[model samples]
Target: MSLLDFLRRRGSAPVARERLQVLLAYERANRGYSDLLAVLREEIVAVIARHITIDRDCVAIKMDRGDTVSTLEIDIEIPHKAGALLVGT
Candidate 1:
């Protein structure tokens, strides 16, 4: 393999590990809700897409269950327009 390819893979190992850890945690927490989560994510993305241009891959949804309450948390990353100044760097 080329040196560039080797370096690229080395650089991304940590990121891949982090993603895997998150997946494991989510799977453990959500258990049997995989199907429902997929559908819910799709629907939410569709609704949000009706108004703005967003990267679907940037959307994240997490559900937390408690004894008396369940909370659904959503995070959507809105892409900035070309030449737009961001408030926080």
Candidate 2:
């Protein structure tokens, strides 16, 4: 059976040889993506900082992979201005 057929037949087909080959190639290229994500996260935080008050430590970005697709999720927590104003002098 073809690779695609094999994958369709079984969700996680036991293609260790093929899987390793693909993983090695992906890992080789993913270093750049990882670095880019880190830089992108910092840049995003910087941009958001210019507009609102946020907790940098709460900024989160993650990559999730599924059988057919992958996703990138970004989550940021912004502080409540009203609450802050209430506590201020």
Highest TM-score: give the candidate number: 2
50 in model 2: Cα distance from truth in Å?
Answer: 0.9
- Can you write out model 2's per-residue Cα lDDT over 43-88, one digit (the tens) per residue? 9999988777778898999987665787989998767783465477
User: What local distance difference test score does each model get?
Assistant: 0.80, 0.79
For candidate 1, the per-residue lDDT at 58 reads 92
Error of 1 at 73 (Å): 0.6
By summed lDDT, the worst window of 10 consecutive residues in model 1 runs over 80-89
Alpha-carbon RMSD, each predicted model: 12.4, 7.6
Specify the poorest-scoring 10-residue window by lDDT in model 2. 80-89
Distance (Å) between predicted and true CA of 29, model 1? 16
Clashes in predicted model 1 = 0
Kindly report which residue pairs in candidate 1 clash with one another. Answer: none
TM-score, structure 1 vs. true? 0.52
Instruction: Provide the lDDT at 14 for model 2.
Output: 66
